[model samples]
Target: MRVTDLTLGILTLLGGIAIYLSAMNFQAIPGQEYGAGTMPRAVAFVTGLTGLYMIVEAIMSGNRGIGFRFAEWTRSGAALARVATVLLLILGYILVSPIVGFVPTTIVVLVVAMLTLGTRLVPAVIVSVVATIVIQQSFGKLLLVPLPRSDFLSFLW
Candidate 1:
């Protein structure tokens, strides 16, 4: 865990630096001072600071009995299988969404993902459908982002 933390901290620091440098390209306007870079810069600064703190803590605290342990191939294989299942479900969503439209596709994807992750059918279907509806409404209706509409469901919206 310590090794993982250290690696993640270093990666985050590098990522933050990259974000900050990239944000520098968005030059500020004179009257309207805040540029596209402003929010990114803030995020980068915070990320960098947190990463630095983690590194310092790791160094001073002396490992804290946490370290990396590579799993056996069998365990790793199972983990990979779970990841692959999730990926396939996501890919299925992308491929099917255009045909069935966003809501139905999302519901199907979510339910499938929940089942793949070991949730039971009834709960999975209910939670998946409700979550999909909430997310669709939030991003589409409330945020004014246009979601793909099916001919069948267009009237309902």
Candidate 2:
């Protein structure tokens, strides 16, 4: 199940480039020495450096080239099942969110995900419900972002 550090480093380097590119578009503050983009750009620079170091470390570990194989899912049905279930859950969430509203959709996804991962029924239900509420509040209330309300639920909205 161990992945190659070189692959991770390459991915991290790409991520850093993305962050830096996005940060470049951020508007700079007129009076402030550091603009909104400064900190993010700095982080991106660090990520790039760290990724480079990881690549070098991987090489120094005597591991040759990039072809690290994944754990054989064909040999482990349970592992494959778990991965498939999570992917399906994510797909369902995307398709359902705008139809049922974010709160209800998130609740269902979290519950299903926990159950699929073999969590106990009672704990899964409790955690799913709590997590759903917290996420809703965090995005909807604290962040002042309005969640999508289904047309079917328009009356409630």
**Model 1 bad stretches (over 4 Å):** 1-3, 64-76, 99-157
For candidate 2, the 10 contiguous residues with the lowest summed lDDT are: 148-157
Global CA lDDT computed for model 1: 0.79
CA RMSD (A), model 1: 6.3
Which tens-of-lDDT digit does each residue in 1-157 have in candidate 1?
1256666677778888999999998978777879788999999999998888777777677753345666565367767787888888778877888778888888888887888778999999999878977887788789977787776545435
The best candidate in terms of lDDT:
2
- Clash totals for all candidate models: 1, 0
Off by over 4 Å in 2: 72-74, 93-157
Compared to the true structure, candidate 1 yields what TM-score? 0.54
Q: Write the per-residue lDDT of candidate 2 for residues 1-157, one digit (tens) a residue.
A: 6558898888889889999999997877897767889989999999999989888898899764675676767468888888888998899988888778887787788988898888999999999988877776688668877886555424433
User: What is candidate 1's CA lDDT for residue 47?
Assistant: 92
Best by TM-score: 2
